[model samples]
Target: MSNGYGKKSNSPILASVLHGPRDLRLEIRSVSDPAPHELQIAIKRTGLCGSDVAYYKNFRNGDLQAVAPLSLGHESAGVVVAMGESVQGFHIGQRVALEVGVPCDDCRTCQRGRYNLCAKMRFRSSAKSVPHYQGCLQERINHPAKWCHKIPSHVSLDSAALLEPLSVAIHAVRRSFIEQGDTVVVYGAGTVGLLVAAMAKLSGATTVLISDVDSGRVEYALHNGFATKGYINTKTSPLTELSDKLMAAKETAVDVVDIACADQPDAEGADVTFDCTGKEICIQAGLYTTRPGGQLVMVGMGTPIQTLPVSAAHLREIDIIGIFRYANTYATGIKILSSGVLPCLDNMVTHRFQGLDAVPKAFEVAGRTVDHEGSLVLKVVIET
Candidate 1:
């Protein structure tokens, strides 16, 4: 801390703290002024994500568990209220998106511009490192100016918060290296999947087919025009046996590809496939539905180990690409949002709750398959 940071704020800060599983308490604490190269942001919007829900319900997201009270939220946007003298290129009242992960700039991965893969990275709201770096669920926070992305003035704060997940889709599409007129098959119609499909179309994919187990989600994707067509994956049965899963995946792939190009009659598979569901069957289906020499991007994370169809991938010479969060996509995401190329961007957030008190309810709704009225629950936003 330096400069004006020594002067503490008299106004108390409000926060929704996660003490444990399903235990979210509204607490008040004093604010800390921004340090040199830091900006104090008044958080305006925070979107609930699957990872956040996982931590709320199970006290863990995959292998990482929260052993201590940790505020859970990272997809967020805010306004700059204060800046340290050392920070330049930013001023007060600026709208910015918080790039939750902070990586060691000196690392080889960071030097290569793949900082998302940096081993020493510390992402907010995550318990990977002890004394977990708190998240953006609070009223105000101090963050490094470099990690804060200035958003376009015209963009909605909801969409600004969405840029975090949108950046992931952007990174996934970038890894695919898709060319114009390519066909893409996306498994999962969730927020990430829909965003990925939308980005794929915007990236010049002639056909973007999205699939999901939920019929409502499929309809939503088609209605939003994010998908050329939607497929309902009701026949998929979770099987413990690897061979059975493979056979089922192959069958599902054939059925899906048959509908991918209805009039073509001979459309074998997609030029690229993305498994955003992270299900083993979905991964296997991606292998089966990708054309020879094509690429399949694993954008979603699942179990550390799963039975994969390595033989098929090796024989077909299909490149399997892996994505970890995102690297260098915030500026591009801001541009995409500001341009309004995707009109559905505004409707991406299907539910809204207000204030820090509603965060718990928002997480509850986010974890549900559908709302009480049976409406499709997409992104849940907490507006402060």
Candidate 2:
């Protein structure tokens, strides 16, 4: 079978490649048109995410090490430039949010309705898998039509590019099983954390409280209406001088939300909590802030191993659930974006760069907490 790239073009596609740690380069490569089951896409906008920034700076992310030249990017959206004869659902010129994790449908996980866990999953622009599945940082990609979801006309390519990360937030919220009036608390105010807070509100959370180490992000979350209350966590100690600081941060988040809803005694503690920062401290605080029988959903990725409060969890019967990359959430995310309910979603893209030429600087700005002017930048976009 042809690899989907059919006929060769005179001009080679310009792609961003990571040669090693802190080594990013632009290379020219050949690409063919779409094959039988594929659709050729002209990548328009790509979001620079934490994982992508990690791979660029350290040549690794958690367990996924970059052993060879790898192209880095996954959150993206584009328009179909061409399609194979057998492709039925998509047509040329249709705008779409590309789903990067393509799985083997015949696998056990896929058969069980968990394709994200498929053993043979192939992801684009990822170092997790060998022969590194090249990502959509280039001019074009011949992707499976089944993995592409059409974006509504109301949404811009930039918002569609963010659907991938939004999907993760959507999946996390879904896993929490939030009820109409449940109180929710989310740790971290980064891109994913912001989205998680927004999703919690849209999913019917009566009160959503967000906390982050960065004061700017916390203020942004509150000002943008993503969270009902925001707290800036300034403590870094594990124990020494930690008790009071941790309590203060927790109280600022939990107390304010509860105090506002003083009529409901049941709302004293958060019914659902999300650890979007994955730090041991945040995880510990999440456990403490959740009500008995409440659920703590882990969404962020951090150190592989960490200490857990087994006794506290056991006594309170707190359900601690882990969420991997999102599964079956693309459509819901697109719908949410199209609804225009999250008005601040567009403001998240604080910085933008054009074409592969600006990829290096884009990754640089994305990896930094503060920009050149010492201001916080929520998200960065690379437009091609």
Q: Score every model by TM-score.
A: 0.96, 0.92
Candidate 1 regions with alpha-carbon error over 4 angstroms: 1-11
Per-candidate local distance difference test: 0.89, 0.84
Model 2, 1-384: lDDT tens digits are 343434454337899888998898899987676778888889999998988988888999888898899888899999998777788977778999999999989988898878988878999877877888998889888899999999999899989999998999989998888999888889899999999999999999988889888889989888899998876776655564555645654655455446434556655478898999888778877887788898989999998997666666799899999998888899888888887888556689999999998999998899887799988888999999
Error of 1 at 287 (Å): 0.8
Lowest summed lDDT across 10 adjacent residues in model 2 is found at 2-11
Q: For candidate 2, report its TM-score.
A: 0.92
Among residues 3 or more apart in sequence or in different chains, the pairs in candidate 2 whose N, CA or C atoms overlap within 3 Å are: 6-33, 125-135
Q: Supply the global lDDT for candidate 1.
A: 0.89
List the pairs of residues colliding in candidate 1: none
Model 1 TM-score on a 0 to 1 scale: 0.96
User: For model 2, what is the error of residue 8's alpha carbon versus the real structure, in angstroms, after optimal superposition?
Assistant: 3.2
C-alpha root-mean-square deviation, candidate 2: 2.8
